[model samples]
Target: MSTNTVAGVRPAAEPTASQGAAAAFRGAVAAEWTKLFSVPSTWWTMLAGLVVMAASALQLAIYAANDNTNDDPLDDRGIVTVGSVVIDSVELTQYAVLALGLLAITAEFTSGTIRTTLQCTPARGRVLLAKAVVAGAVTFALGLLLGGVGALVARPTLGGWGSAPAAGTIGDIVAVATYLALVGVLALGLGAALRSAVLTITVLFAILMIVPLSLMEPDIAVLNRIADVFPGVAGGHFMAGDTEPYPGAVGLLLLAGWAGAALLLGRAALRRRDA
Candidate 1:
């Protein structure tokens, strides 16, 4: 009887060392992280975010020092420290974080590097997960650094009117960090799903900026509620150091929901579309 295998058929090729290297999730994550931090934009954007936060806080401190108000100590402190800067600085910083996050995924698409990335690790979900982890960690660290410095610098300038942030202030700092990180993840997901940086950034800006402003009208209570669920608004509530109609935990959960939904959508897009 003829052999079942074709005459030219050979034994299956052994997995190469490089392919074997990416066997674990941690290895894959490390590889992706190396590529991410190596990009120049990552450093530039991070530096810019830090600078903006510091400058805004400094400006507020100078102004407060000049005015030297004794009214409502916390308000004076917030003014001198937080400065005249609105939560918008934090919101703007989110845009930079978003850009870095989008580039994390879109860079692969733009350079056709994603094929190589996939070849090294065939699981698409893992690739997305790795990107999310790296982006989230970086953004979170930067957020904490920026927020703390901003608060610290402003405190003394405000004539020490503002009491030191309570232990709960740590929670607020953590919330800001979490918000920045989640926004980065959300942008990564959008970039992956859309595979277009401009489109992703535009959509994110609209969702985070325009939507909130438009919904703030008194007639738009329902829309306002919906907009409040976004990371920008939820983050605003946390950084504002005030209670809102919604519980702080609820705001966090809402932000989490946005991040989770975006990630799921990106994953679905990845599975459905060709690289």
Candidate 2:
């Protein structure tokens, strides 16, 4: 150790292992955020998702209003609440967020930039974690935006006949945001594991929509149970506060479990595979 005699001079100490790891994680997160926002697709996807949400919400609201005005209102259609409208819009337009998450990680692989990324950050797990964080955060914000816009667009029309319970509507919005964030994490995990944007998107869509739809029949108990646990169904249950099969919290937990499982698989694949 050299003792510096210069005024206000001191030798800098090396960062501890934990501190180094934290710094590396922070760097990775910053890099991922930069990479995600630097592209035009992110903005375009968000805009498209917003448009779809607004359109869906407006249409639903108008229909509800029109039905209420008629003498022979459809009793089969349950009360059209703000929460339902927002959640329904989100359900219809979640593909944009999923696409965002898939592209966040797979773009690197597709463009051969993942090799450079791995070279720069040798700890593959940290890179994946960072990507998950970035994708989750962006999708969460997008969810909030979409939910808020849908509510605003629907309020004028819905006020004529639909109900807008403050607590329920706010809960639904927050739940949608949480669901979208976790869904993004799931997509990130798949993207990391597969390293192909197209394949990951297709597989994610199937898992979220197609499989669940195929198993939605109530007559098949086993299939219904399996479908209820899927991410899309679980998210719907949580956001809508459904009590059937299980409580809303259980649905959130199931969705979270799915995301966690995907992340573990992604981490394992990332560590074992060559960049």
Candidate 3:
């Protein structure tokens, strides 16, 4: 046997700190961030939310301004613009956010890139988290911008129909933005769990839209009460400051429960499924 070991047969070196699994996750997040913005649909959805909100607010403002009288000029205008327009805008723009959330994951499934995503971030949970984080952040920022701009634009047009929002209006705006982000994250989780955009979207639409309409009956008072705790219902209560049916804090908790349950269920499915 040769006294010296062959150079080519030297012992394998230990993995470097840079090569650790945590580093891989950080890289995955960065790549995911880039991939999220690179998609054209993302920008389109965001723009749609902003435009719809602003346009609705502007229209309400103009209507309020034109209808203003000596007795009711600015204050009345403010109420119509903020109360009616903002509610309508929230309902409409949320659809765009839903689409964005659904596409965030379903597109990967359609394109067969989910496998590649899993390969890079094998934990599966981390992948889900990364998707939620990116989608949630974007939706929240857009919601805040849209809401703020809508409020600002409506301010000038409120001849007497509107009043300036109180000092705590910022808190209300923040709540709306937070709600939007939570809804987006919930949608993303649902998408991942279903892995089919059409099915997920349809289910979401029915839950958010149809159920509430259908349950508006005297005979269904109990059902309506239960449905009031649903995400959409709770969201409406939050935006309008309507605590007749449910207290504000209780409504918020109900919404939080919906979000948390959806997230947990989706995470479990993501972990168990084939990605």
Evaluated with lDDT, which candidate comes out highest?
Answer: 2
Better of 2 and 3 by lDDT: 2
| Candidates' C-alpha lDDT | 0.76, 0.87, 0.76
Better structure of 1 and 2 per lDDT:
2
User: Which sequence of candidate numbers ranks them by lDDT, best first?
Assistant: 2, 3, 1
- Model 1: lowest-lDDT 10 consecutive positions: 77-86
lDDT of 2 by residue, 1-275 (tens): 34563566786778999999999999999999998989999889888889889999998888877776766656435467887888888777888778888898788888989999999999998999999888888899888888888888888877756778888888788899999999999998998899898899899889999999999755598999989989999988989889998999999999999888999999999899887
Instruction: For model 2, state the Cα shift of residue 99 in Å.
Output: 0.9
lDDT of 3 by residue, 1-275 (tens): 34454754765577787677677667777877888899898888888888887887788677766665447545443345354455556776788778877788988999999998888788888787778878788888877887787777777666566666555456656667877887888788888889899998888887777887688655577888877877888888876677679766776777777766777777899888876
Candidate 1 vs candidate 3, TM-score winner: 3
Shift in Å, residue 169, candidate 2: 1.8
Q: Candidate 1's residue-wise lDDT over 206-227, tens digit each?
A: 8888878878866577887877
Ranking by TM-score: 2, 3, 1
RMSD of every candidate to native, in Å, equals 7.0, 2.2, 5.6
Off by over 4 Å in 2: 1-12, 73-79
Give me the candidate number with maximum TM-score.
Answer: 2
By TM-score, the better pick of 2 and 3 is: 2
